[model samples]
Every structure is written in C-alpha cells, then in structure tokens.
Target: MTGEPILEVRGLCVDYGLGEQAVRAVTDATLTLHRGEVLGLAGESGSGKSTLAYALTRLLRAPGVITGGEVRFHGRDGSLDLLDADAAALRRVRWSRISVVFQSAMHALNPVARIDAQLTDALRAHRPELSAAQRTERAAELLRMVGISADRLRSHPHELSGGMRQRVMIAMALALDPEIVIMDEPTTALDVVTQREILTELMRLKDELGFAVVFITHDLSLLVELADTIAIMYAGRLVERGPARALFERPLHPYTAGLLDSFPPLHGARVRMEGIPGSPPALTALPPGCAFHPRCPSARERCRVDQPPTAAPAPAPAAATAAPAAADGERTAACWLIDADRETPARPARTPGSTP
Candidate 1:
C-alpha cells in the first residue's frame, strides 16, 4: 500500500534572522510524502510544523528564510526542486501542482468574496482556458466534494459556520486538483465532532481525488487516526518519525513519548494528564548537545555532550518488540535512548514543575 514519492525533503532549514543572530526555526527537517498518503506532523506550538510547511511551499516572508534544504516535487512533468526555483518557477509549481490549506482556514478565506468567487478565482487564474460557466460548474463540484451544497455558492464567509468555512478552503485548495496538499492545522478551532467530520471528509476526498496530504497539528492522537505516517518535531528539528501505529505503540524519542502521554484518553478510564515538563529551548541559545536533554526523562550523560543523528533502523532484540517497519519514508529519530539491541532506560514518569 505504498504510494509513489510525490514530495521529498532533505536538510530543510529555516531561520528567522540574519547570521549571528538567526534563530533556526526548522533545523535539518526531512521527510517524504507519497501520492495519496497522509503524513502527519505533530509537535509543540513552536516546534516549526507551520514553518516547515511555509518554507516548503515558499510562503515565508522576509524575516523567515530557508537557510538550506532541497524540496523536490516529483510529477509527470518531471522533478523540480522547489527551494531552488525562482518566483516564476515556484509560481508555476505551486497551486497547480501543490496547494496549501493554511491554518485558521476560515481566516484565510476572503471576507468580502462570495463562496463561488473565492473558490473559482483560482480556477480562473490557473485554468483561464475554462469559461465562466465551466469555472462555476467546477466550483460547485468542489463544494459538493467537501459535503457542501451548490446552493450556498453565493453565500459569504460570515454566513458559513466554522466547519463550512474550513470546507470551502479545502474545496478551493482542490480547485485545480493538485498532486499534493499541505494542511496546517485545518481543524484547530472546531469541536471534536466537527474535527472528526472535517477529517473524515478530507480523507474521503483524498481517496476519491488521489492527492497526498501533509497534515500539521499538535495533536498526536488526531494524527494517529488520520495519518499513514507520523513525524514528531522538537526544538525545531525532526526528532522522530515512523509509521503512525509504530510511533504510537513504542515511541523511540522521549519527546514523542511525552507527547503521547500528554493526550487525555478518549475512552476506557479517565486519568490525570501530564504534559512534557519544561518549555522548549530558544533556538538562538539551544542546549549544546541534544536540545532535548534538559527535559528528556531518559536522557543520559552521552546525551549531554553529543548530539544524535536520526538513526537508521536498529536491530530488534529477540524478546523485545521493535517498532513497526516504516511504510516508505525514513524511520529514524535523534534520541540516544532508543536502540533495538541495547537496553535503554525506560522514560521516567512525569513530574510537575520540572523546568530547564
């Protein structure tokens, strides 16, 4: 069930200032998106999930810059490195080949524009060959795809509910049927039921349309349910990534484990929720060795002086169960605590008031 590689990222770094004072918001972040696959990125508020998405799509403004990286989009037209592409080059690749449903999607919609206009505008711009009738017809189809009625096409943003507004944004993103869709917290403000509905609708559309999705959110639990693969980011770096189930069942990184623990169980029994202790370090003055050492419960002396690269697949011991084999992308993490053969200490229970 592996889809073809639609997007590949390597050493993606993004900074927010000039040299000597630059704060690296996305450091050496790497991952892949296969066609029709859902890749979920989960992390803290500032772990750079949105930044990575913006950088990949070349949406970052002046203060944010892509310091280094390669973002290649493989298409029938052939592969193109988005990072190296000029404005015109990127313009051609974006939207038509890839589209983004930004965070707070409702806010992204034009307040004054009608739903039909907002959704069909991209089509008018990208597919000028289509006449007004064709654009309007296509817009209605897009709306229907997201479970919205064509009758609401003339409605304004203020008339729609939060969920419907988000749906309009999704429909607009699919206006051109792009190969890849990067969704940044598309369901952040919705209620649990709405979130589930929106996610379910998105998955159905993805299946019907055959588009790869890179869904970014802080909720690991949500990702586990929707994403085929999950990548955990930390302190501006991708600390761990693996199959969604694998990462959930036996997370390799302490941060990943803490993130999972932080989630309140939806069913079974109610328990006290303990989030990861200590705030993430400022990128300008990150810890010398591993950025996570200060907060990692299983961190050792080795983790204090030397940084660990995202490791290759580790051999599983006979008695211990290993993390599931990755479907396609890299299955690695930057934690020293996890080794398939070596006995790593179990993560310590959470402690309140723990600080850096």
Candidate 2:
C-alpha cells in the first residue's frame, strides 16, 4: 500500500569539486518515503548510496556540493524545502523532526559518558521544559522500549556489547519520536545472528513507533526480507526501484538481477553465486552510456552509446508477482532493455574495423 509521502526527493544531484574535475556522486535520485514505510537503498560502496543520504540531510561537508535538486520534508501542517532552509531552520528540524543512526554505534556513542546521560542529552536540549527527574525517567523508559534493561543505562559505551550499543543508538534516534529515521548501514560490523536480531527488533520498533525508515546498505538479500520497497543504485543513479518482492522475483534491469545473484539462495536448488563482474566506474571518468554496461552481461550496442531516461520506468511483468498493485506502484528501471520498442529501433552498429 503506497501511503502519503513523508519525504519527497526530486531530481537530486551532488558533485565533488569544481569545474572539469568534478565527480558526480549522486545524479537524479528521485524517490518518496511513505509514512511509516521502510525504503531500502542498496548499491556498491562507491555507488553514491551514502552520499545521497548525507546530502539529503545537509550533512555533507566541504568539497561535497549539492549542485541541484529539491528535498521536501512534509508534515501534517505543511512542507519545508530542506535544501533551501537556513541553518537556524535546519537546526530546528534536525534531530527533532528527522534523526539519523550512523553506520557504527560505537563511534556515534560517547565513549566516556554513561548511557543514561547520553540518552537524555537530546531530550534536555530540545525539551528543556522537562525537569531533570522527568528526563531521567524518560531515558529509562526508552531503553526498556528497545528491549534493554533500565539498569544498563548506568553503564558506559565500553561496557555494553556490540548489539547493545546498536540498540542504544536506536533508542537515541527515537528519543524525540521523529517522523523519519535514516539508518546508514546500522548493522555493518555485527555478526550474522546479531544482525538478524537487530533488524528484527528494529522492524518491530518501527511498526510500534510508526516512524518511516530509510535503510541503506549493500545487502540485497537481507533487504528482500526486511524492506517493503527496494531501490538499486549504480554509479550515482538509481537503476531500478519497485516493491521488494516483485523486484526480487523478477528484476527489470541486468544490474538488479546481478545483485540478487550475488547472494546465495537460502532455499531451492543449489547453484554457484555469479557475482557482478568488474568494478563500479569511477565517478570522475564514467563510461559514456549506461555506467553498468561494462559489467552487464546483457548489454547491447545501444547500451554503450546512449544514457537511458530516468522517467521511463517499464512495469514488471504481471505474471511474475502476486502483488500487482505494489509492482505497479512506481516500478522503474534506467535501462534500454526495459523498453521493447527502443530495443530494436536503434540503427545498426558501425563495425569497429570496417570502413563506413
């Protein structure tokens, strides 16, 4: 079910550096996070996945310039353009309206401070009206909500396990009950079992708290089970996006299919994992046409000559998925193979060695 848009990003673009040497980190990233929905963002390390998230929150530092785009944050009252908001306005909205959970909780958490002091810091800052006792009580309750015993609130970061540290970070992110939460690789260094437990708990908390989440990572397999919608990014642009199950069952783009194959199947006949070949293109010197053509097994002559339009999204085949409505809900891919007419209409390719 496509709910109302809580955050709408349109034609976003980000570049690093000035003039000729500029590297386009994120190009034309457009997506909407539905209210209380989980939108998964997956891509290679250098594919501009994290860059898009950081830029959207205006967390990018120098050399990372937001060349173009619009990031609108919607509330029940009205919408605010985050890109144009002044520092004062942004300070007012950030943490209170939209919070972030970084990749590593250890680094995000204060090493010296007790969990009790750390958790209540946000509440003390924005919510100054509450007394000290009230803030302490609220902090303890938040820890309990995330399945942690309130007694652990007295422990320092070094005393907690990796999983517990992550839970603390989650609790802090929800301190203000934000409408949206951006989690960037929140389970990176944890063990497989720990990762699964954390994701499961996070999903439960999301359902109970009613906050939209932007879960970014390179694990398509994990996302297939946890996410409601999945979007694949390659080289700085979104190549395919749709319902998680539909995209998993029948991917429209070759790159998307390759990512799905990268992970071993949990069931069904056993087969070798044929990971995507070659590395992602360098942003400063990207390929002429589609960025993924070099490693794409199904690439054609046209794929090497022209870039595909971001607007023309081919609907997934109806027979492949049971959720036709979700499949029809904004499924799109930036690949020439998706367009049936465009596939055969291109002129014959010129021979490399033969004279014209």
Candidate 3:
C-alpha cells in the first residue's frame, strides 16, 4: 500500500474440480510484490507454492482452475489485470512483464536450437522494432549478465553443462527486462558448488537489474540469506508472511518453527534434522478447520474444531520464554497455539521469517 507495488494478488483460489468434491489447491492467498524485492515462497512439497506461482501468471491448465482471485500487475502505462486479460493480452505480458526460470533448464531450452536463437526469439517477440544485429548485441549482453561468455550463445542446450544451461535460462528470462521473475527451484539440479555459484550470481543480477523476484524453493537456509521477505505456506494456504528479519526473530507460527528446526544454522556443524511429523493431508479430503491441525504438535481441541485466526505470535514472558528475541517485534502466523484464548504457554522464540 505504500510504495508502488509491481504485483498484487488478492483472495486467490485455485480449485481442481467442480461441485461439492472440488479441491482447493490454493486457498484465499494474497500478497504483494514491490519493485526489486526478493520474496521467497517456502514450504514442503504439496504445500501449493508452485500452484501459487503458476496462478500468478494465469498458467494453470485443465481441471486445475483459477476459481477466484485477482492478479493485478502494475505496468508503466497503467495497471494490467492479469486475471481479466484475454489470451493475446496474456501472451504479450507473459515474458515481457513477468518471466519464469524453472527447475530444469534443459527442458526449458530447445535442445535443437542454439542458445543465441532462443535468446533472439525472446528479444524479437518482445521488442519487434529492434533489428537482428541490435537483438544479437542485446543477447550477448544478457549472456554476460549471467556470467556466461557471449560465445556460449552459439552452443546448443545439449552442449552446455547444467549450470551453464541454468544460467542461460536466467539470461533468457532477463532478456525482456521483465518487472518480475518467478524462479521455481532454480538451483535444484546442480551440485553444491554450482548451486552456490548460481545463487551468488543471481543475487548480483538482482542487485543490478532491480527487478522483483518470487524465488520458490524448499531450501529454507538459502532463502534466509537472500530474501527480503518470506511467506510460509501449508496445505495451500499462507500460514505466515512477514518481513524476513521479523519472522526469523520471533516466528509466530508453529508451522514456521518446524521448518526452522529442520534446517542447520550456518555457523553450526551439520545436525540431525527432525522433519515435521506426518505428510501433508490429501488435498481432495483436506482436514476440517486448519489442515495443519492434524500434524501440529501444539494442536488443541479448538484447533480441530475452528481454524486459528491469523495473528502475531508474541515472545514468551521475559523469564519463561527462554532468551528474548535477538530482535524486536513478532510476525503474523496461522496456528491455534498463538490464539489469545488458548491456554497453552507461550511458545519458544524463533525467527518469524527464517527460511528453509
């Protein structure tokens, strides 16, 4: 509401079926992306993080439908309502205003085409006024932006290493000067060294381009280091969303605490990670009230009967809550243990927005 938000999502719901048996893949989700901010969407598999990403671009297909929501993309000339846009309108906006760098770069790039050709296609599609020479010049610059040599543009997808191919994917996404980039597990296929290198390069690129990023990954630790804000999802609903620092310091949600507990701290040696107990409930028959209630260690009778209202999870009392938050302020969380009416003692202090 303050700065010029580049993207706004409101009451977004994506359902997979019709009538009483309909399953909600994403439920009443809402968020905003400000210019140049990197917002991490973190959760375990089946939490609907990817669904939300695809929905933002109106990319959901078949039985998977955008049952309700408004995705408003703020553009230079005026605000564009993505949910209301026709096929042609959506096509024009897809790569030009918003782009995607998915998990598998090899599949994203055409194995038969040289990298230069793909990059050129993106340029010509978005900037038709540019001549072939001009587009080639721009393509070379993009390759350089992602730390690849311009000469690699002549190479085909099969000829490049996984990291190089991923970099090419990044370069392609950047070619159109999109206002936002959605990366779904961008570093998943590479080795540790390559992952770090790519992430470092991505951070640098983000700094240089000043484009908002929606980075989706289950790796919470990486997100903690790179994201400006974090949103934790559970069973297709955003259980918590707040400033990264605030969320990490005084995480208000039980689900978030479980995620934090599962990751080893950067300074510490590798410790045994205790994953959240039980798998996510089936979407077709999601639990009554809060979907997380079935697996939540802190779940109460009320939690089973009524969904917890989203609220700030305050630090425990000065003496009882262990050490006070390293930082001030709590964050928004969705858990019944934080309910003001609940009798459970104050939970331990954990960063609200800390990542995987």
Candidate 4:
C-alpha cells in the first residue's frame, strides 16, 4: 500500500569543491520514504548512495555540501526543511526524530566507554525525564530489545563482537524512538549468520516499531530480500527505483539489470558473477549524459549524449503503462533505457544461470 511520505527529498544535489571545479557527488536525487517501509539504496561504492543519505540527514561535512534541493522531514506538527535548520534544531531532530546507524558501528562506538554508559548517554540526552537509574534500566531494556544481554552493558566496546556492537548501535539509534532510521551498511562487517540474525531482528523491530528505514548497501541479493522498495544508484544519480519484487522481476534500466545479473541467485545453480566492465566514474570528472552509460551494455548513442528523464514503469502487456509506471514512482530513477520507447530494441537478456 502507498502511504503518506514521512521523508521527502526533492531535487537534492550535493557538490564538492568550488567554482567550475565543483564535483557533483549526488545529482537530483528525488524520492519519498513512507512510514514503516524500508527503502534499499544499492549501487557501487562511488555511486553517491551514502552521500545522498548524509545530505538527507543534514550530516554532510563542509567540503561536501548540499548545493541544491530540499530535505523535508514530515512530522505530526508539519514538515521541516532539514537543509535550512540550524544546529540547535538539528540537535533536536537527530536521534529524537531521525537517527543514523553509520557503516562502521565499531568506529562509531567510543573505546573509552562501556556499553551501559554509551546507551545511557543517548537516553539521557534525548529522554531527560529519565533519571540515572531509569536510564540504566532503559539501556538494559534496549539491549534486551536488540537480543543482547543487559549484563554485557558493563563491557567495553572492544569486548563485544562486531555483530553485538552493531546491535548496540541499532539500539542506540532506536533509543529515542525516531520516525526514521538511516542505516549505512548495518551488516557490513558481520558474517553471513550474524548478518541474517541482525537483518531478521531489524525486520522484526521494523514491524514492531513502525519506523521508516533508509537502508544503504551494495548487496543486491540481501536488499531484494530485506527491502520493500529498491533504489539503484550509479555515479551520482539514481538509475532505478521500484518495489523490490517488481524491480527484480523486470528491471527497466540496463544498469539495474546488470546489478541483478551480478548477484548469484540463492536458490538456483551457482553461476559466475558478471561484473560491470568498468569501475564507477570519478565524481569530479564524470562522463557526459548518463553516468552509467560507460558500463551499460545496452547503451545507445542517445545514452552517451543526453541524460534521460525518468520514464514511467514498463507497461505490462495487460496495461499500456505498466513499464512506465514501474519506472515512475515516488522513488524515481535517472536512466536512458527506462525512458526508451518500445520501438527501440532491448538489449539481449542474460538469465541468471546463463553465460553472459
């Protein structure tokens, strides 16, 4: 079901450097994050996924700036433009309304402090009503919520395993009961079993808490399983966005198709992963037109010269607009293939088990 958006990003552009030398780190990223939904941000390392996430959370550093566009956070009171908010306003917004779980949970944690104190610090800052004892109790409760024993609260950050620390990070992020959780590779350092456990716990928490999630990761297979909607980025622009099922079933953008082809299917016979031929282009010196065109197998002449406007989802034979509508969602993409008319010949499809 399509619900009212809790976070809306409009024409958001993040830039680095000055004058003519400026690099567009994130270009015209526009999308909506609905309450209680998880939107996966998937792409190569330099595709601007993390940059876009930082911009929305108003966490960009000086060299990295939001050059244009708006980050709107919808609250019961109304909408807040996070881009324009001051430090004081942002302090109140962070952890209270929106919290972030950075990629490296270990680094995010303080080596000097124990888990109990760390959790209490967040609780005391946001929930000032809680006394020291209450905060400790709450911290223990939070640890329990994340499947970690409260007894471990006395242990230092280094004492806990990577997965446990990540759970603690998640607990801290959820401490103030934020409306949105911006997680950047929450399961990156964990092993497969730990990752699955954490993901399962996260899904359970999402179902229980009903907070929206902006999940950033490069793992397309995990994303397909965990995310409700998937947003694929290439270079600095989004290449595809749609319901995970719809996107995996019939990806419109060539880049999107390539990413899917790269992931080996869990249930099927193992196949060699066909990586995109080239690495992501430099943000400072991106190619003209579609940034993904360089690695895109289906690139046409138009793809190299002109950026394509996001097209509607590909129309199913039953409906004239299914494909176009799939391409066109609150989560929009920027890829030429998605906009190409039916008369244009599609590139050869590569099945998962077939040789590319």
What is the total number of backbone clashes in candidate 3? 11
Which 10-residue window of candidate 4 scores lowest in summed lDDT? 347-356
Clash-forming residue pairs, model 1 = none
Tell me the lDDT of candidate 2: 0.85
Candidate 2 lDDT over 70-151, as tens digits, reads 9999965579999999998888788888999988997989899999999999999899999999999999998998889999
List the lowest-lDDT window of 10 residues for candidate 1: 347-356
Question: TM-score for model 4?
Answer: 0.91
Off by over 4 Å in 1: 269-272, 322-330, 340-356
Off by over 4 Å in 4: 269-272, 319-332, 339-356
lDDT of 3 by residue, 180-265 (tens): 99999999868989998999999898888778899999877678777888899998999988777655654567778677777655
Model-by-model lDDT, in order? Answer: 0.84, 0.85, 0.81, 0.82
Best by TM-score: 1
lDDT score of residue 104 within candidate 4 = 91
lDDT tens digits, residues 1-356, model 4? 34679998989999987788788888888888998889999998888999999989888887887899998999755789999999988898888899999989979999999889988887887788888999999899999999999899899999999999999999999998888999999998789899989999999998998899999998887787788889998888887788876676667777777777775555545566676688888877778878777877777799799988875644455354334454444444566555435232232433333321
Worst 10 residues of 3 by lDDT: 345-354
Order of candidates by TM-score, top first? 1, 2, 4, 3
